[model samples]
Target: MTSTPLPSPTSTSGSTHRSPARARHLLSKVPEVTVWFWLVKVLCTTVGESFADWVDARLGVGLVATALVFTAVTAVVLAVQMGLRSYRPAAYWLTVVVLSITGTLYTDILTDERGVPLAVSTAVFAALLAVVFGAWWARERTLSIHSITTTPREAFYWLAVLVTFALGTAVGDGTLELTGWAPGTAVLLPAGLIVAVAAAWRLGLNPVLAFWAAYVLTRPLGANIGDWLASSRAEQGLGLGTALTSGLFLVAILAVVAYLTVTRVDAPGAVDEPGTR
Candidate 1:
């Protein structure tokens, strides 16, 4: 049999290269990973914790019912996100906000509503997140969030995100329950952990791995912040009502998103491979 010679790396006809526009297109759905991204994410997580509590307590809808309401809202926003060809700051962050609330509610449902052990819920969510990542990698061969260009990738991305939020909630609250630590002191744990992860990433750790590690840590960090803000003085929190805490974080998130929208600072070409989800 005759042997066929392979084309060189520079050969255009031998393979395909994404056009600049196509490259932009593929990167359009997800925001760049940046300090701003992390700031806004933590804000979202904080809002998720406080807002869910406010709704349930104020409406008297109970945990499960409150979760269901956020679930519906998340579904609607996620649909809108999936429909967009390019990133719209409002739509994209709205999805995250909803997912954050829904995911927190999910963990609460297991631990508070169903009497499930926080350890069990933590393990379950961790396992589920692992499965999602495993399947996503098995098919796509990459877990990097920067490549969230296609519908399937976006789906996997969102699934992983939801599970991470749930897992973070479980682990964070579980630690609090086990240690009986005050919320004030508890916030330091996750915050310190994230700083370590960031340091590792800077010190040559795999960016994707570091990114995800930090992403998971942010959940607890933000949750703790929310708890510290919303809990009463007796509970070692700031005594801010859930409504006030939620509003504060929500406004902060909006301000950041607006800045990003106007500056396109989180756009695809804004930075190198910096997408969080």
Candidate 2:
């Protein structure tokens, strides 16, 4: 045959475009709901409770001063977190740890310093969390972290996170008051409840409902664990001390975050494909 005109470059360009679009579509898929995610999340909450105690009780910083310090630090870390264009586990987790400590302290101040009853604090924070969830769902139509792609969604996510920590602290302490159980004994209830929730989830419970329920439960679980680790043997704990507990958990968090950052293990929201929308 006569030399066929070279196919127009547009054809080759279209093929290239299609390939990249597919690749991006795959990349945009949210991370798998992994064990590592839950593990690290629990660790962060543990650090939050223990770190706040260490600063306030052991260091004699006082609750207000400690709260101020953690708030300032959280603000700085959160700024760095927001500046990242993609997921960075180290930055993200660091921000979370700080937020956890700060949120716990906020509840403590309301309960301890101002003499607010745990029940009242619980009710107030519960209402606040409800408001956050309502606004978040109203605006984004989804509260699932799996779909967090935009800045507004991320803002809502963090807001909900802060409220959850505060609410969890209230609920945990409230339960202790009601049950009059030692910290070690108190740990079992939340821990057992969480296990039950996980079992239920595996047995066909709704994923979103299970996820949020577990998320709320984890705060108290981690808090109880931290308290058990740090309290004196007289209090039914291991006598780790708040400082040791905080340092131990913080180091573990750092190691895990470093690994995740290097491996890009939990980054989210990559470029979307043309047809994916």
Cα lDDT, all candidates: 0.80, 0.74
Angstrom error at residue 183, model 2: 1.8
lDDT of 2 at 192: 90
RMSD of 1: 8.9
Model 2 per-residue lDDT at 240: 98
lDDT, model 1: 0.80
lDDT of 1 by residue, 127-189 (tens): 999999899877666776666666777888899989999999998999899999988899999
| lDDT by residue (tens digit), candidate 2, 153-221 | 567778888888999899998998899888889889988988888788668676566777777788998
Best by TM-score: 1
**lDDT value, residue 1 of candidate 2:** 10
Error of 2 at 116 (Å): 0.9
Worst 10 residues of 2 by lDDT: 1-10
The number of the candidate with the highest lDDT is 1
What lDDT score goes with residue 89 in model 1? 85
